[model samples]
Target: MDQKTNTVASILFMVTGMATVGVIDNFITYIAVEVSLWQFHFLRSMIAVPAIVGFGLLAGWTLRPLRLWPVLGRNMFLSGAMFVYFGCLGFFPISAVAAGLFTAPVLVMFIDAVWSRRRIGPIRLATACLGFLGTLLVLKPDVGGLGWANLIPVSAGLMYAFGNVATRKWCEGESAVALLWSYMFLMLIFGALGVIYLHVFPGDPSSYLTRGWVWPSASVWMWIAIQAVFSLIGIGFIMKAYLIGEVTYVSIFEYSMLIFASATAWMLFGDRLGALGFVGIGVIIVTGIVIAVRSNAADN
Candidate 1:
């Protein structure tokens, strides 16, 4: 396909993937009331890993990683980020959690600048500042009752940034399918650990983060299956989008997840955001566009 055609296709894939994720993720809150985070991850991965393998085999895609250690390291960070991101969903609005998670691109820029010993130009630095301000506005941390939980989503963003760096530095040339397999496998492992730890030292049954295994109701099982299926579909499209399109151009479309998630949350759950929150989301989206454009230019 021509470059323009490829870009259009990529944008479609990216938007579809983001919308899928945005919708499925809001359902996490529904299940969170009934199951522990660990149990949820464990069960979701249980379903996802086998399904991924089956699909990989049928499609004749190699699931083995070219570099095992790097893939493992990348999965560790990415899985950890999801762990935190999902955990936050049990407590915060999807819009807030998603806005924080989308900070990954900005964090990636800062990490790359420091690790490469490159000076940040004025525009990039200003963009970073705006991004930070946006995060604060979205999170709206209460100083009087400030606690670590308020910053959990940003921590997820940090881990996601590291995972992105690892992907570029070490997992280059690896098959996207292989990376996806390894990531799901690691999530399975992490979920098992969380389940075991909680079993040994259980906490409040009602607490999603602390609660251990519970017999899932039919509804819980259904939602989890839905989560697994939609997540695979979303991830597959996102991987394809990156493979076919310019990274800078494709990455910008990911910001669309913010809009999808926020809108879906409002429609489905009556989750509403104030004017300042919407403004904050806008700022973050604008910052992400600036970063993508500037990064592309710098590469040229």
Candidate 2:
């Protein structure tokens, strides 16, 4: 009973962490409207670098892990995943982007199954199909309506799943702070590449995607600071949750981020999905909950 309680609590913590990240990302979208994409990444990395180091020291964690190359490679995948995710925000609704990204859990399941050469159970396969259907409803991609850019967030979700698998399979025993710092270092490197690209070949100034680096205004600094703080708290809880709970069960709760993002998008940006979209979101959550419950039962 106590184990069950702890599992439930950990799942809640994971959901809360994802919700916090979703809300923070909405604020990031607002900030991105006025700042360059890479600039935001660069500045957030700057703040997170010191903040993560301080966190490691305060928590008395070993900042150095025994395995270096594997950890770096895993984080590079994560950084690329997030880079595409944030870049999509420049061109798409946060809710839509989030809905697409939440497919990571399904991808995780599929990847694990393939890697193990195990047959996917009937119920799990059905739920995965249903989830994909829900994503289509959210997208509502008609002929020539949704462009190739829509694929970006979907690809990000796949990369994120791969990164998560690498974390669990190869990077165990490493401190969460160490994992986080590696991720931030890659973010800084990616940001520098973005800076160089923009400077050498600029494009439309009106679009955030192609805009060159600019001096951070006071407002940008405030938003970047907010992102750094909330991200630290949220990612810490999330990493702990992943460490403590069954990955399949815990990952289902990550869909809650879409719920939070949808509300935040509506409240802050006057963005709301249509009736079909809401229904699709409902389908995804209901199916995810069912899968999570079944997964937990099997574990027991």
Candidate 3:
């Protein structure tokens, strides 16, 4: 019974974290073009690093793992996934990129099945397919605009799938706060290196792809600060969720992110979806319900 309760709570935490992540994306979208991606990561990590470290220290938690390389490897997969996914935003619509990234859940399911050599029951398989279909409908990827570049986000999904599974399989004993700090620290290092590269070889600031290292305005700093706070709270919950729940089951809940992002976009940008989009939203909700119900059954 306790395990069941924890599973339910973890699912809630994961869903809430994903929703908060949606908000973070919205905040970043406002100033994304103004600041280079590396600068954004570096500046945000400046705030996140201290905050997370302080919290871990205050709580008297272990801030480092027994084995560093595996943890670093896991974080690298996720960080690389995020960077690649964001880079693809320049080539594709945010929705399409997100749809590709959402494929992570399916990959998670597949990887788990293959690694364990266990058969995925029919219900899980059906729901995964339904969820992907719903995501495709919601994203409405542009067939004409699609090209070889579309592979980037799919690769990100694969990386993310590996990272999520690694969190559960390899780093189960580690503190979520510690793992969080490591991730931020890695991003900080990479961000710093990227800024140095921009300094050495500058490019057109106006060009979206080649641009790097712009001096952020006061408002941009404020936005990055807000995003950092969100990352702390949001990522903490997600880390806890993966630590507590089954990876294959937990991953399916991430589809709710699209729903959350759509709602945020509607309120913040006054962006409304058409009828097909609404239908897609309904399908996603159904997908969530199916997964939640099945997860409960499995838990019992």
Best by TM-score: 3
Per-candidate count of clashing residue pairs (backbone under 3 Å): 0, 0, 0
What are the clashing pairs of model 2? none
Model 1 lDDT tens row, 17-120 = 98899778988977998999999999999999999999999999989998889789888998999999999899887756765687776676667667778776
What TM-score does each of the candidates earn?
A: 0.84, 0.87, 0.93
TM-score of 2: 0.87
Q: Whole-model lDDT for model 3 versus the true structure?
A: 0.82
What lDDT would candidate 1 get against the real structure?
0.78
| Ranking of models by lDDT | 3, 1, 2
Model 1 stretches astray by more than 4 angstroms: 1-15, 131-145, 239-253, 277-295, 298-300
Angstrom error at residue 9, model 2: 4.4
> Model 3, 63-165: lDDT tens per residue?
9876798899989998998778766765555677787799999999999888778888888898888888888777765434766777778899999999999
Candidate 2 per-residue lDDT, tens place, 1-300, comes to 465675787687888898889788887666777778888888888899888888789988888866999888788778888888888888776756765677798888788678667777877778777876775565444413455766778889988888877777678777777787777878988888888899999866777878888877798789899998898778767776665665655766676677677777778787766787688788878877777667645432
